[model samples]
Target: MTLRPALATTLALALTVTLAGCIAPAAPTPEPEVSDGLAPFFEQGVDWTECGEGVDCATIVAPLDWEHPAMGSIELAVSRIAATGTARGSLLVNPGGPGGSGFDFVRDSIRYVASADLMEEFDLVGWDPRGVGRSSAVECLDGAAMDELLFGQWDNAYETKAWVTELEAAEAEYAAACARNTGPLLEFVDSGSTARDMNLLRALLGDEKLNYLGFSYGTFFGTMFAELFPERVGRLVLDGALDPSIGALDWFAVQMKGFDDALVAYLAFCVGQGNCPLGGTEAAARSTFTNLLDTVDAKGIESADGRALDSATLGFAIAAALYSEENWPALTSMFEEVAVGESFIAFQFADSYYGRGGTAEYDNNSFDVYTATLCLDDDFQGDEYDVRSGLDAIDAAAPLVGGYFAFDDYAHVEAACTAWPYAPKKQPGMYDAAGADPILVIGTTNDPATPYAWAKSLAGQLESGVLVTFNGEGHTAYGRSNGCIVETVDAYFIDGTVPTSDPNC
Candidate 1:
């Protein structure tokens, strides 16, 4: 199983249903005065065309290599809605996939992503980062190859030499496909480069400083921006933050524990509901769930499409639902359907997580870019022995969920990195964005994807960080969370008001 990093469910059914209202496109803005190697990129005008009702779409060009502008350029897809009221500046947003389509987020789900107040005061902008949808993306497998990669059966049992060899071979094949298809672009898709791209966008958009709202993995992107151009920071809100200092193994371990804890929390709520499908008690529910997983692992259930519903896919479905409390009822429905030997609901959840469609093609290149970006951004801090020890620790932290994540000693995790064609471009370390404006960092106490500890870690690391804590569940806190979180964040952006202290809501 590929243990990907924390991803925000901006495309979740609940949020995506809320369509952002459009406004008349504003007149073209003039370019900022600039003279540098990157000046042409900043001075180039964006030719915006109305793609939707009042939403304008445009493409901006940035250097493929920031250090050397002569290397060539890549196109970045951008979309925006003009402010209803007079605009202070553009409010750039990222829904956080590392590969999430910010352009789609703005075009489709702006109301859900941003508050009405903020949208009225500022032009809401979204863009697909490098190697993402609608931009210069990383392409590897087609639908059939993707299905085999994500859901194909493994005949071998756990921990054997056969299993290890098979896993390593599969990872190598995938890496080779990425290298062969993506070419040199694959090496520069890391968050560090993306952050540089954002700065260029900020300048091209005619904003004096960046005003960004980044969720989940976008938090890392935002932090990288802050670290790189501390003086250019304006109003930045990083919700569901990731601690950039942590290495790959720790990222896996904490993510597993977070999901495990979230599962426990869900069970606590589920058992109290009428006709709860799992069991009467949390422990009973866990036992029932594990048994179900074991049964699925041992003998998979065949879906109508003839695909097997195995333990790994079930785990993905579970993780997908755990992203939001709003999705808990869907989890219960999945459990109920699977109990009756129906894999439809489970498959639906898993497919959404993977961005797969009913047709052969995927909706986007998220899965491909997710892996590519991760391999480049992650710091493999140890060798094979250290990796083995780390995997054991992960299993210990999440005794129930971790097993589903791995078959045995997960040498495959490290093996994938070892076989990756490119070296990691960004090193893992603390980012103290000194000389920057006060940045608001928000964290949910029980976020399944990005654990709450990461928020505290990031907040402490930033020299001008002000933490807004939400003592609740789910992946992010700003839009879906309580009034305290929404108000704190909205006030920070709309007005220049930073919280005096953590509300601890």
Candidate 2:
């Protein structure tokens, strides 16, 4: 294995049973509802009770579908770590998953996600977006069904007629499943709607302005917030930002390239080490990994649990390891095991990436919400010619991982949203928050998920955005061990200091 950059890198019937259920309420607070349409949501108080050490958990109601305020409502799970010192205001944080669990992020991983200075000065708040974990989630397949759909093998290659048909079928089946299980809430999980829900939460929190820190997909949510409620935006920091201006195909292509570049960097690092499993040269390492993928594609390896580790799973495993340099040693061990005909570690990596737990159950509904939100957000052309063109570009840009990423035997981008039932409610385009306060956008030079270019593009797109460059590896930059990056971000959030000019660290 290689290391990256600086060693851091059914019909409506089903809907009845599932959609009728409500999320188990946490402590409830009594607040009077006003006559306004949004009053119930805004005036609703959170009955916070101690959940974990120094963490309070609560749930608030937002309309299941905002468009029809009279319709039913959904409960959003929220968690907060109260400020130790004088609180400036609420610092709403999201870990980025058009599916990630902000509730868990704050409740369990607050120390990793925020700095001591931040924890001391702000009430760190995290909420599961509508149609996500703990929130009124979009229920779909059961664990076994999901395991099969997500991890099972497919029989066609990209650009092939069969491949396109199979992918469209899978997507259609997925959409139907969601529609059957999620009811009216299915269409309301879009980023724009979530941003609206966020605004209501802000009001409920008694904050006139929204202060947010969003990472990865959360950046998209932050962008939508600034665009929708520019005046309400306050101290927004979008790290590993996404460029809303780009279409889905373009975004996927760019991400593939980023992962490819990271792979090469990892290969270089591995070669420098004495006992790299791949080979001595970067090219040699690429060739070795490519060959390994081919081998897996032809005859999938068997995991200790007896599950088959196909090329698609292995590819995902490798990509997951590239997210951070801390995982580099694990990747090396994975490759070592794979070399000896073992694939349990590869499956483990893939499982971790998908948020799977040790008992073979998913920890949350991240994947379900991810697909639902993305389908509702991006417009997919699903044109075969366009798919082939995108595949060509990806393969040319990233030969080592491109095949696995764009067209492996299992899945391809062309098939993703083609058969989705809902039309894109949130169109992909530029965001210009002209009247908002300064927003800080941080980008890592070799970020595999949200490429650095996106940060630059997002910063340029927002009239008041300032780009902060971290010329290093890994996904998000702030609070990940870099003192310079940490200090700059802290100053902005704590002292209201915006970088006079773009700063490259």
Candidate 3:
């Protein structure tokens, strides 16, 4: 029951908003001269055409490898919903994934992802970063092959020699598939390249400075952008901030603890509601979940579609449900069904997390791009022995899921990248946007993906950062049912008011 390397899916639904005010239109500023051999990208124009209800779709061309402009180019899929009233400026939004489809987010889910006022005032802009959905995406195995890869059964005990060998083989196979199908573009899909592409986008959008709302991994992207182009940073809000300084192992360990704590909270709430099968006490709940995992691992139950509900898929289903408290009821139903020898609901939960369609086709390349981007970004260089040595402490801190998460060879980037075709390029370190204006950093106290401490660290690192705390549960803070968090964020974006002190809602 080793965790998959796709923990980013927990924060994949992160949405951001920027408020705009009606101001007299000024003449568009002259495009910045493209230094560093980015002249063609800087001078390109987006041909916007109506693609959906009130949405305009276009493409922006960028060099496939920014470091070598001679190596051809890639098209970035872009979309925008025009402001209903007078426009203030473009409000760039990213639904975090390192892999999430920002273009689809704006074109299909803008109303839910943004405040009505923000939508009205600002032209909501979204684009798929290179190697993400609708862009020059990273292609890997076909749908059926991916299904087998992600949901395949494993019988060996986690951290066992057999498990390590099997998982390593599987990861190597996946990486080879990505390299075979994705080609040289895979080497250039790191966040550093995406950050530079964002600057080109800013210039193309006629913005002298960037006004961005980034969630989860998007926070990492936004932070990278500010560090690279600090003088151009403007009106940036990073919700569910990921601390760029942490390496792969620490990042996974911290998130494992966060999910463990969130599960405890969900269990407590479930028990208080009566008739909860997981039991009344926290210890009882833990025992029940552990037993369930053991049961699934020993003998998988049959799903409605005839797929096996093995421990790995069951663990992924539970982890997916823990992303939001609102999904607790569904989670309880899944557990109840599994208790009664049914596994359809449990499979559905896992499928939703993996973006599997009704016919078993994947909706996008999120998992592929997530793996590619993380392999490029993470700095793990350890083998299976190193992974095993760290498990005791991880299990001590996160008693329930840590064994499954921490010992999984697939979760270890080094295991995957040791045989990967491309070498990782990005170096992990502290980011301080030295000359940036006041930036907003939001953290949910019980955020299951990007932990609260990450937000604190990122805010402190930024030269002029204002921390806005949301004392709540879930993956992200904004656009939840918290009026306090909403009002504070909206006020900052709308009126340019940075809170004098750290405000907790």
Q: What is the TM-score of candidate 3?
A: 0.92
Which residue pairs in model 2 clash with each other? 3-266, 4-266, 9-324, 9-325, 97-100
C-alpha lDDT of all candidate models, in order = 0.79, 0.76, 0.76
Candidates sorted on TM-score, descending: 1, 3, 2
Error of 2 at 302 (Å): 1.2
- Writing each residue's lDDT as its tens digit, candidate 2 over 1-505 gives 0111111210001111111222233222223433467667766666776776677777889987777788889889998888999997899988887788788777767676578998899999999999887888888788777776777666775457776677677767877888899888888899998998888778777777889998888898999999988988989999988998877766777887888888888888888885889987777888998898877755657866666787667877888778876677788889899988888778877776666775458867777787777777876644343555666766676677744755531133345456566777845355898799999999999988788999999999999999999988787887674888888899999999999986788
**lDDT tens per residue, model 3, 1-505:** 1222123223234433332432232233366556657776776666776666677777778999988898989989988988888878888888887788788777767677578878777888989989987899899889888777776665576657787677778878989999999988999999999999888888778888888988888888899999988998978999888888766667777887887888888888878888888877767877898898877766658776667777667776777777778888988888888888788877777777667886669888877887788878764443343445556556666767544544432354446666678877755355888989999999889987788999999899988877889898887777764887777778877788789987799
TM-scores of the models, in the order given: 0.92, 0.90, 0.92
- Which candidate do you rate higher for TM-score, 2 or 3? 3
Instruction: Please list the residue runs of candidate 2 whose C-alpha ends up more than 4 Å from where it truly belongs after superposition.
Output: 1-35, 156-159, 358-360, 381-389, 407-416, 426-429
Candidate 2's displacement at residue 203, Å, is 1.0
Better of 1 and 3 by TM-score: 1
- Compute the lDDT for candidate 1: 0.79
Worst 10 residues of 2 by lDDT: 9-18
